[model samples]
Target: MTDLIACTRAEFARLRRWPAFWIILGTWIVLNLVFAYLFNYLAYATGSSMRMSNGQPRAILLQQMLPAAVPEVFTQGMAMFGGALMLVLGALVTGSGYGWGTWKTVFTQGPSRARVAGGTVLALAVVVVALVLTAFVVDTGVAAIIGTVQHQSLALPGAGRSLLGILTGAVILGMWTLAGAVIGVLARGPALAVGLGLVWVLVVENLLRGVASIFAPIRAITDHLPGTAAGSLAGAMRTISGEPTPGVLDILSRPASFVVLAVYIVVFAVAMMWLLHRRDMA
Candidate 1:
């Protein structure tokens, strides 16, 4: 336990200084801020000249940008854009170690192979939590600003609901991060793993989803996909707020979404550990 803690700390220390990690994180924050607030605000500002995307009136659009909508804004982008960026971060953090020989050096002579993998994953978990909380805070600030400017009430989302939203974001993002870690270990390089991960997240699953709509039977399998599960979890939060937010789905019940995401995270973590512990580093 002590050794694992030490390993996690070491990994976190290194990741904090990693420019790539910051770049990925920064990108997500900016994307979340823009998509959740900027676009909505712009649409609201356009007034009667433009149609509201969700068919809600301009007033509803403004309400969506108020502080009380923080929980919704916190998770609105997570299913698609946030998850993709996180996968990139995880892939680069783990797979890049191979290209730089960090994994080889550490696994070959430094510590137990399991220990190193555990530490890296534990560290990545921290990154996942950091990303979620950062988004929440930033969205809250922006929403508060908009609320004040528009003279709306600054009331916040319910505490319990907000906590649940945070947990949902962590679960959804955690699954993707671990999936990227496994892919990194599998490909043994950052570029290939990131390419494959992005394709699966951004291209492949989306195409399958379109096909599934045409072939009802395909919906069964697509319903269980990682992206689907992640999107469902985010949608669950939206359900509480009374509408499906952008880039999410309301296909699965909340419990089922949590179960599916938990299963994927475990499978990915186990696969990554097995590959690291048993495969040849050469």
Candidate 2:
């Protein structure tokens, strides 16, 4: 346990200095700022809210920019767009080590492969949690500014609801991060791992879902895919906010979506460990 904790701290320290990590993390934050708040705020100011308000009243555009909407609105990007970026962060976490021979050096220094994998995962989880918390803070701040400037109420989400929303964001982010870690382990380099991960997340999944609509067997399989599960998970809290986002769907029951997402998170974590164990790090 001590070794694992040490490794986790070490991994965290290393990741903090990584430029790619900051780039990807910053991108997610910027995306949240733009799509989640900026775009809607623009629509509200320009009287284009009717067209961009998901078929709701123009007032909803203004309302969504207020503090009470932060919980769900802040998470709208994590479904697919944010998840893809997190995957790249994950790929860099593990795959870049192999590319630079860092893994080989670490293996020679006597830590067990399992310990290193665990450390990587633990550190990644911490990062994921931080991302969610950071988004909540940023979103709430922006929402508050919007509310105050517009003279809208400054009421916030309930403490319990806000906590739950943060947890939901962490879970979604964790699953995709680990999925990227697994690919990083399998590919053994950041470039290929990133390319493959993006291809799967961006191109392949969409194509498969489109095909699945017409083919029954494909539909059955697509229903359980990780992207589908993530989308459903993102949609799980949609009833609370009324914000519509791309890649957020209701294909699975809320319970089923959570279950599937949990399964994928576990599977990817274990797969990452097993892959690191079996492969020659040297």
The number of the candidate with the highest lDDT is: 2
Q: What's model 1's lDDT at 275?
A: 92
Q: Candidate 2, which ten residues in sequence have the lowest lDDT sum?
A: 49-58
**Whole-model lDDT values for every prediction:** 0.85, 0.87
- Cα error, candidate 1, residue 54 (Å): 6.0
Number of the top TM-score candidate: 2
Give per-residue CA lDDT, model 2, range 134-160, as digits (tens). 999999999999999899899999998
Model 2 stretches with alpha carbons more than 4 Å out: 49-56, 240-243
Compared with the true structure, model 2 gives a TM-score of 0.95
Write model 1 residue lDDT over 1-282, tens digit each, in one string. Answer: 887998899898888888988999999899888767787788777764243235556777787788887776678688888888888887887898888999888877778999989998888888899889888988899999998888889998899988998999899889989988988988999999999999999899989989999999899999999999989888877633334555598889889999999999999998998899999988
